[model samples]
Target: MPRSIRYFVAPAAMALSMCATAVVAQSFSSSTFEIPKPERQTFVPAGTSCGSIVLTQSTSQSITAANSVSCNAGGLHSDNSYFRSFPLAADINVCEVQFGIETATGASGTQPVTVNLYSGTGAFPGTFPGSYTQIGTASLNVPDQAATIFPATVSGLATAGSNLVVEVFTPDGQTAGNSFFIGSNASGESAPSYLQAADCGVTSPATTGSIGFPGMNIVMNVVGNPGGPSLSVGSAQATLVDQCASNPGQANGVIEPGETVTVQVPISAAGGSFTGVVATLGIPAPAGITYVNSTSNIGSLADGNSATATFTVTADAGATCVTGFSLPINVTSNEGATASGSVASQIGESG
Candidate 1:
């Protein structure tokens, strides 16, 4: 979550010593026009290997010779972080994340790297290392062509104008013995990705295109449900139970005819947090029934959390076999999440 800041007097006289975790060395970035050519390599399909379409910038199978950019630190340095951004298709919870890297070999003596998920709020790689309050994080050990599926679940993250930003932090160590390259391709997702290495004169996140590699898209992917929020999260549900004062012991999930009853529908919340939740009648009561009270307060619910909602109604005494009745409910929260559903009930007059 942190690193040191150093002062560089000039760009030419780029030799500077960094404080804290940053290594002491001259800053470096490369941008030579290399012909992008593929030479028979195992293809890494961007398909949903984790049961859902994984998100990624590069869709090409093999890394082109000219596209295979350096791992994390473009040059010899300690503590370098890279960022990539993408817009999620509405309510989809991220199930997995994977970023590619060439893996440091020989003298590099690399440390484990972390994949972090941050709330998307401005144009990506613009000025944000793109990390404010991280939503989820996972660490992976590097291999020669490390493309580890980061094991983490991210939810409730709506695209706040900006796309979801991913931070890949590499602790290349201060020694700068040797450096590895983060996996990259010529796919060029969005502005060639961004770098946040302060020692490299990149105090703020600047596009790699600005530094040097103008044709690079940090090889990273996100996988998850594209249809909606996870079944286990970000959803609301309810079950109706009837409570009657006159019929003691007869109060069992059904609405009895001619009885004034309180229909208690417990509203449940999951995924993101919810507050000031309330339920209101979405449709008029069916024929032969009258609504005494239609609004019910659900209160507050923390992430993966709570419920309590109810309404009162009465049935006509002469109504027999009151079927085809539906109670449509509209549940809303302070955050503006509106979920609507209805429960159908059939009433039988007591014999």
Candidate 2:
């Protein structure tokens, strides 16, 4: 039997709570990947036109712990089409879908991603009902795992439980098409960021990036004159990797030189409890970025005022249940900087 690994992430303590003991919050993680070997194989009825979408199971085997299932909703690379779908349940508290998709490998740019869940039956495949709730929509510029969540109030969702289909669509409707599969039971581990952006003056353009050192997508947009200046960006680059040292790992990216730019980088997790050695690099402006919490700030550079974002990968690995990970980000620039962002992860497991 393959070795089973569980992940756990610890929460930070409040500064004023020095006399109080730190509290560790239990977070859960989940994966949206292709199943090694999917059983109960069921294909869409003829003429249903799954389009470029497909469902796959990893290797047909038993995983001691929950893993990830892959979704090929996005079409093949040559075609550039994408796919998405949702779980068949009503009054859904929380719904998540995970999968690996095309991203910035060398420099083909990144694939733009859009995820949606609709209410549909066997007969009406083309015409979906409801508001086509947007669980996650991103312009992924890298190739990695994609995971997103949708709240219960998604428009057009079935109030009652029934056999419903979930669909993932490519934003531009590229010819290569797109593909997205479900994550393994082990995947859906945690909820990284759930705070509103307006309050912080920053927001995740899309959903939080994936786990481990997959890559990071971030947007730091600011408007009008608050206590600070405004800023925006078109695009940028970021990356993450595992060092296997006493620290968890590290990652960084380049922020294009401009009043505003969009940045994308890789993020990762090694499926076990490992201290993460993290850092932020190539920050064009220090005055524009601020750390929400001083405790989470690990390192910084003074010369160019360029700072490195740092945090720990809470100890969740080597446990009995799933673990979760997340890195919150905030950006500030002179007015006119509309920052949009997204993130992804490269999940690693132990045997």
Candidate 3:
């Protein structure tokens, strides 16, 4: 089955340089921002032609720009800006790039300039993706813009596993040169299906506002009984959640004909305060399965206990924080055995 992919934010500029690779190396002479804006010339001029969006595992491939410029220690400028689309293979999740300045012409002065990189689901943006949209940026000063080298990486960006779009733009009104593929390279990542997370529910008195920091309570009563089978992971981890901070996100426990256990996941309000809390079930899942009550549907845990995944908001004193939230229940076997939906009270506030 085709799997869903997840992305992680890459490290800032310096961290990437420490571990540069020759295989996935750069091609442009310089990736610096240097072209001076003419009194009226647009950086990415009106009729400029953008490049193609292709899916490939190759880390580097030669590409041509619609228009080209000169070179400096920094590298090249884009009269012809380019965009490339690549599919992140199922076995990997991260992509990296180093910029070079080349094909230069005119001007030789250093200025603090910015470059923007954007990631989205489709073709390149006709206009630039918002300044707020770039996943990463770099700044440099050089004899000429193409003389400076800009290095950047894209990490933890989720992909449906195919046709993910990546584009580079000049932020200082200068245009970006065509980035050539250096090699078919990527950081190996575990398959998304194997990732899992575990957490116990929180049981607490509401104080006022948001409680339940990332880690506060013990995740009790794992859905499968004790001594159940263990989970496996490739590169990523299996993430679980304690949905109900003070209340359960799913039914409390299951009482069945064959195996029955009382599993409890408890939650507590932070030091006598009440605030809205967000307890996630897990990062979104791949296609083969989904999590319910923090357990795989194949079977119930030893104790028959379940967990919760939720997002709740709390108001200030007397602001009417959420009174309760609902739990979603599912039964893999008999349809009639399922429990009706349930709601529990919000931890009461003290202050």
TM-score of each model, in listed order: 0.49, 0.27, 0.24
Q: Comparing 1 and 3 by TM-score, which wins?
A: 1
Kindly report which residue stretches of model 3 are placed more than 4 angstroms away from their true locations once superposed.
1-81, 91-95, 104-108, 111-115, 123-134, 142-150, 153-156, 171-351
Query: What's the residue-level lDDT of 221 in candidate 2?
Result: 10
| lDDT agreement of model 1 with the native | 0.55
Give the C-alpha miss distance for residue 243 in model 2, angstroms: 25
* Candidate 2 global TM-score: 0.27
> What are the lDDT scores of the predictions, listed in order?
0.55, 0.25, 0.24
lDDT of 1 by residue, 115-135 (tens): 787765555655354344566
Q: Against the hidden true structure, what lDDT does model 3 obtain?
A: 0.24
* Model 1 residue 127 distance off true place after TM-score fit, in angstroms: 5.5
Say which prediction, candidate 1 or candidate 2, comes out ahead on TM-score: 1
Best by TM-score: 1
Kindly list the per-residue Cα lDDT of model 2 for residues 1-351, writing each as its tens digit.
Answer: 664433222123211111244222212222222333432222211111101111222222122112321111122222112222332433321122233321211223344443334444332223333424332222333343332211111112233343233333333222444332222222222222111112112122122333221111111110111111111111122344334334333322222112122223322211111122232332222332322222222222121122233322322233222222223333322222222222222123223
Which runs of model 1 end up more than 4 angstroms from their true locations?
1-24, 29-51, 59-61, 65-76, 106-110, 126-132, 144-156, 159-162, 175-178, 227-351
Worst 10 residues of 3 by lDDT: 192-201
Candidate 2's error at 196, in angstroms?
Answer: 35
